[model samples]
Target: MSPVLQIALALGSVVGLMGFMAGVRHLAGTWQIGSEVQRKLVHIGTGIYALTLPWLFPDRWPVYLLVGLTLIVMLLLRLPNSRLGATLHSVERQSYGDFLLAISVGVCLFLAGDQLYLYVLPIAVLTLADAAAALAGSTYGTKFFRVEEGEKSLEGSAVFFTVTLLISVICLMLMTSFAPPNIIVLSLMVAGFGTLVEAASWRGFDNLFLPVGLLIFLSAHGTSTLGELVFLAAIFALSIVAFKIVAPKFGLNAHAVRVYVTSIFLLLAVTDPQNTIFPILVLVAHIWRRSVAPCDSKFPDLDVVAALVLVSLGFLTLGKATGPTAISFYGIAAMGMLMGFCAIAASASRPVVRYPMVLALALALFAIREGVVRLNPDSANWNGPMWPAVFICVALTALGPMILSRVFATHRVVKLTFLALLIPLPYYVISTGF
Candidate 1:
């Protein structure tokens, strides 16, 4: 089909899907159905429709156009006067799920070009598994646990895992060339991590994290043997167990620990295991600060995890684009140093004390990173930052807490600007050796 015709059909199909969702919402409202049910209905419908993208557009521009228009519509739905908001916004918790859903579709489609299974599998889980978890939780959930935003039930998480495992198996069998052993290992891996991510995520972020994380994991480890995959899984499990044991000693909340652990495992799956050490140290420092002087802040832990993940993914992308250099790892380590500074800055009331402590921590972490590199020279080789470069990165990261305290000090939802500001520093430092 011609590009113009393809774009036309895509837009029409999206409009039709919206009309169907609106009709469903109207009927549900007439019947006094719960808002959550109405939202999930729309969610499922959107995901199912998204699955048809490979067939609809021969090029990605059509998908981008569709995503942009749909995102505008979703944002419009958030307006107080808009009737559509009633269905999607009925939940009490704060959420940007609708926005994330639209963005994930476009991004995932782009990443999976000419690879239908890569695209379909993640979307299917996003659709079927997520809806199943929500419904199962509401209907059958009994045991509840606290998270950053709200409480999730064990029953729901279990349902999510089961469904995700099934989806993984089915998608792999039909879509890939993996053997039975590989399929089993891969399905288990996705299911375990997906459940953790969903349980830990708040504010509709699972919509974004689920598909993107899946794509990264599949792309990175798709060709590994069963033993290799199992070894990776074992490392993830052991790390989680270790964190769970130590987190309480540091006075970190269960929710915060889960976010930290899940993000680390996601990193481990997507990149080298050693690459996880930097973020792990940054988190430990944050928790240690919390342990020393606990502050009562309502800012969600998931937001912190989201910020870290976003920054790391940026460096990781740069690594791929630049090709075959350990520049990405260096960039991430630099980010880790910046975050380490921010984490300490959050606790240190005096600049004199904070700066020294941050400097020491950064040097120590860098030393450790060097030791690891020396042990596994083939894994990565990159020069350590000079004293001036270290100071510059620290100086840049110091602005994070200051700006955050001035602008968002009182807000309930923490802005991502602190870490987002640190993004360019790593790239600039590593790319130019400045």
Candidate 2:
């Protein structure tokens, strides 16, 4: 059979299972197993079905096919009169979790090559671990923390971290023959990051970020040093403590701490902390974005100098830098900080500002490109070949949220900006060094 046909058949079976789930819901006497559980049932199926795609097709064509089909089905299901649409319409109604699941699959396939460990790890954890977290938190969760997109349960997040740790350790150990001494630490780091991404995910955004985040961490496996692990651990610990003492309103609860920690860990895992500007900027941007309100301060209340000092100290103790590296670091940090301020400023702005904001982003990218070329002429690694790709990515990172903001009013431009930054900027930065 053709690979595409084989994939179609396999997907048909999965849909049949969904139909069975629909039957189970009906026979259980509710005709609806409730919207959230309905979502979970689908989420659980995706975990299983995702495992089959990479194994069955062994190429990206089927993976993209799956993404396209899922997106089409998801949109069709949203039609007001369709039965399946009515069924799923209220399942995390505002978000595109299923669509992101397919995107994650496509991304992993593209980046992972033949590394089944990398491809399967994210899909399995995202599918099963996330489903487990949701079920545990929703059923038994009592303690809640305010997350940017939604409220998360401590119990649920713990469940997510534990499951992700187990999956990463067992799977990666099998893949690389357990070479790294800090495998346990790596597991903890992945789990912590998984929890962090989950906590930050709003309106089903976890579906998109979680797999992508997992792929980034997995790429660094067996290549990270013991000291790097420790440095990442300390960064998270101190940052969470500082956030608690200094900006508790930044959502420095246990769940939020895990998110912040995971981010720093990913950066350390993927690239040098000395050029740590981008990661710090991304983390701070999210915190700053969350800490603001439309009726509140016009200027940010954040202590920028303190954040600068903490990351700078961490980098200095563990990293080596040259003049060019310093310039690149500060340049990226300045652009990111400005983006964050733009997000904060957007909270109260009128609808007419998006075009000018996009135009400003274009001009900023142009100037940043010229400045980077002048100051970092010796930065040939990225500047030589990947410069245009990097420039496009940075521009997309800055402009994406402003464009998306017109569509999603429930989330501020800043909230959208968090995903925008988290997704693309890290990729550009990591590609430069790793």
Q: Rate the local accuracy (lDDT) of all candidates.
A: 0.72, 0.61
- In angstroms, the error of model 1 at 206 is 1.0
lDDT of 1 at 174: 94
Number of backbone-clashing residue pairs for each candidate, in the order shown: 0, 1
Tally clashes: model 2.
1
lDDT of model 2 at residue 236?
69
For candidate 1, write residues 47-110 as lDDT tens digits. 9989988876777788888998888878777887877677889899988899999888877787
Give the TM-score (vs. native) of candidate 1: 0.84
TM-score of each: 0.84, 0.67
Q: Superposing every Cα of model 2 onto the true structure, what RMSD results?
A: 9.0
lDDT of 2 by residue, 1-434 (tens): 58768687657854765585566456434663677877777777766877887666655675676677767777676677666554455654466676667666776666677777878888889888999999999999999987543677999999999999999888878876655567888888788867777876655657766876778776765466878877866776687677667646554555445545555555565555444444465456546555543323221222232243233323322222222233343334345444644544454456577557645755765565465455444652343434454455455545555565454344343443343345334543464463
Q: Which stretches of candidate 2 lie over 4 Å from their true place?
A: 1-32, 148-150, 248-434
